[model samples]
Target: MQDTLSNKALLKATVIAVFIAGLALVSFILPAEYNIDPTGIGAKLGLTALANPKAAVVSGAETKATIDVPKSVQAADIIEVIIPAGRGLEFKFAMEKFKKMEYQWQTDGAAIFFDLHGEPEGDTTGYYESYAIATLADMQGSFTTPFAGVHGWYWKNKSAQAVVITLTVSGEYSVIGLKK
Candidate 1:
């Protein structure tokens, strides 16, 4: 009799399994991966921070420019930063529509996941334009601002050790620096 379950018992077990899976998805998977915490249980458990920092940035408060650049084109300036292990941050610039800039950046032989994007000024909808997204050790190019706003790279270091990044740029832009 113990070798096989009755049809009713089998059906009940299946239903219970499905219910537990759904609960886990809502309480753990959704919040940890997508930053979706409709039930708030995940936040209570400190799972929301497991989500990619990009999600936080998207939902974060608007940031203002830090340093205003002069009107004339200046020599390329170098900026070096250290990304803490398993952490992420952003370095942005403010520019007017049609302004152009040349940039090059490389890490210390470690590949990093990055998103180069722009957010228009006065936007409250958490909308931004993504110019590039990739995992690479270096990037170099020029870009013309599509709108008067902030542009920057969101660099995520998935490595266990801190990674150093060196960036050089010459453009008509104001340095927004590290974003909070």
Candidate 2:
């Protein structure tokens, strides 16, 4: 009788384990994509797209991107975009410290390390930030406008040859007081 009871217990455990495994397999097959703003925020009003200038690849050339701040851009708002590269590029920012907006790669891509300093204010206020130290990989979200202002995207060629990167911007944000 003891042996019979043990067999019944084992059978029940195996059945339960199989049911859980089937549930996990179904979850894996479901959709996993989530839509997010360029700033990394969950959702916001406005459209999003890659915000970069025209790109060209020239022989024996080093690819670079200069973040251009338009005169019309307000001080309190931030613009977001992406810079595409062949393999990958090293990102350097002009700010003493900076933050990376949230993002997702359409394909398998390299990781990025964001170095930021100073204190974060409002939502993203903090002293230092990094994509490397922190858990974030590729940045693909929104950014908070700084008090003094911030701009520029510097990248290095990850491949043996030259590469051209078009500034890629995503998401839409209101100008605070723009006419719309």
Candidate 3:
């Protein structure tokens, strides 16, 4: 009788341990390592950024084809753009493979949804990649092009008021233009 009781307790303990481990893996490891957040907790905690270092590389390659920019842009472009409420804009520059660009942009204390991405030229398939997706008042970073194409930002103002964006870029790009 005692042996039977011991076997039941051991089986129960083993099952409980496995269940707890599975929960941890699904909730934490899956999001932080693979960006697979079925539970949505990873996105809320910002753990999604930790997955897939290649996301930036894929974005640069994909963004190279999406927008059209001038083939002869200056080495430095400073532009201030105002986006009215509920408006959006796309600004991009023509870049070559391995070219590097430093950029910074800021809003007037109002947050906006921004996509930093790239689309390759001559890709009519309408495919692009995203390096970053942010909802913030400002962003600053530098990118080394993974492939030749157009690279830039698409921003939308969902706020109740107009937002001013001041953008500064210096790099190996040929031209920068706003997509109309």
Candidate 4:
């Protein structure tokens, strides 16, 4: 009889321990980085003010324009690309596409971060959205047009210093929304 009681108690303890461990895994052990807000500050992630690329320039011999974005940025966010006409690198050198602009998507800010390295590896072309989702050191092709509008922004980095990109819009931009 004593042996039976002992066995039952052991089983119960084992079950309890297993349950607690499972809870911990879900709450703390899992990767909650992609999680986002359902509804808080901004309205539905919708169309925002268009970015005037002609209003600014990503210049300097080694001046790279870096833009950081929160991971919450969904596919509907507006990512305006503005390359204002200035005394920046001429179309020849400026036309080169950068092999590494280094970019990332964040949930805390749903921000897109990157830098505009010296000469580009190629040209960045077409319309893109915000959170146009890309990872660090993982990018392809180049941008041709001076101005572009995407759902989100992303880039690759090949430089040494981790550049922090800031979007200096000519107008107010919209906030990004993450999946609920």
Cα lDDT tens digits for candidate 3, 1-118:
3535588899999999999998888888999988899999876776765673211111211223222344333334556666778878777777888888898889879989999999
Model 2 residue runs over 4 Å out of place are: 1-63, 66-108, 116-137, 151-167, 170-180
TM-score list, all predictions:
0.61, 0.27, 0.58, 0.22
Estimate candidate 2's alpha-carbon lDDT, on a 0 to 1 scale. 0.32
lDDT, ranked from best to worst: 1, 3, 2, 4
The candidate maximizing TM-score is 1
* Best model per lDDT: 1
On the 0 to 100 scale, the lDDT of residue 98 in model 3 is 81
Question: Residue 35: error of model 3 in Å?
Answer: 50
Go through the candidates in order and give each one's C-alpha lDDT: 0.79, 0.32, 0.73, 0.30
- TM-score order, best first, reads 1, 3, 2, 4
- The candidate, 1 or 2, that scores higher on TM-score is 1
Which segments of candidate 3 are over 4 A away from where they belong?
1-75
| lDDT (tens digit, per residue) of candidate 1 on 41-65 | 9877867756732111121123432
For candidate 4, write residues 45-157 as lDDT tens digits.
22111111222223333333222332322222222232222211211111112111222222212222333323222336633323233333323333332322222232333
Q: Where is the poorest 10-residue window by lDDT in model 4?
A: 87-96
Alpha-carbon runs more than 4 Å astray in model 4: 1-5, 32-66, 70-180
